[model samples]
Target: MGMRNHELVPLQLIAVIASLKHGGCHKVLRELVRYKLVAYDATARRKSSNNEGYRLTNLGYDYLALKALSSRDAIYSVGNQIGVGKESDVYIVANENDEQMILKLHRLGRTCFRQLKNKREYLNHRQAS
Candidate 1:
């Protein structure tokens, strides 16, 4: 979908694209909606059994832009998706030096916070090793 488009997207599609579990995607989406970063529409509630849909608000787009700019390594461009895992998606990214790098977006803690916390701590410990 276009960045400016406000089309209502199904939760399943978003979950698949982000490599996040359905429950986790829903939780995060609720938070985003609460923060006004995403809009959840239930207009089809009467017509359809699955009534929920989501669309990114302008704030969400701005947040993404800010995150990109604040990164230590300047990202020149984002390329195609390289891989998709259970909890993340890997994409090809080009840095200021034109070096190709893999960018992984992790979707942790959709179902259980304990598991996410454990995994995060393990990663932090490994990084500090």
Candidate 2:
């Protein structure tokens, strides 16, 4: 999909892009929202409007990345998360031949509050003064 300024896309537009019936497209979107893969804004639907909106969550993007990797034979099984750092999580994965690999997912625009405070303790001291 091409990048758009709006995060929430209209249901009708999505239906037209996917070439699916409006009802069918809504059903698929409902399922994704139920799984927390998509965010739905029913508040946007006015009394006279039938259009709803949806946007993919971070988990949804991660799911797409995982699907692409598996389809390309880069990952077969997702093993346990071996490490968690300030910016990312490292996972041990395996390929078709059982070769071990590392998968690191970086958190964009996210951070652990506790870790952030600890890492920037000096800044906190300056503010108090």
Candidate 3:
């Protein structure tokens, strides 16, 4: 059988934790929890407070696999960094392969309360206007 794309988010989350920073799993998982991209056993025994590790949902795996293949080329540019949500920094990455895609790197080890407050303020201003 061919490789699937659905496991990307969870696998990438794991990869980011394991490779980028060893202690980033909780931070990464917090950001991805809302994406509905992981299938995990809720009943799995917890080894500690940080025992919950994610397994890739079919969609999550597929996407990460694709990204691993595509992003192998030299980076073309870090075009622009747009703040998509509280937990992500979105960048436009163009590569030597002549492909351009949005790369959303999760902001681990930060609180998003400030972003939430700003969003609320913006909404309140719009309502008052």
Per-residue CA lDDT of candidate 3, range 8-55, in tens?
Answer: 234445665467564476566656666865555444343663333455
* Highest lDDT scorer: 2
Local accuracy by lDDT, each model: 0.68, 0.74, 0.52
> Please, what are the lDDT tens digits per residue for candidate 2 over residues 38-95?
8987564438766447877778877888999999989999999999887878899999
Model 1: per-residue lDDT, tens digit, 27-58?
Answer: 89889989999887867644546555787665
lDDT of 2: 0.74
Ranking by lDDT: 2, 1, 3
TM-score of each: 0.46, 0.70, 0.33
Candidate 3 segments exceeding 4 Å error: 1-23, 44-53, 73-129
Please give the distance, in angstroms, between residue 56's alpha carbon in candidate 2 and its true position after superposition: 1.0
Best by TM-score: 2
TM-score of 3: 0.33
* Candidate 2: residue pairs that collide: none
Model 3 accuracy (lDDT, Cα): 0.52
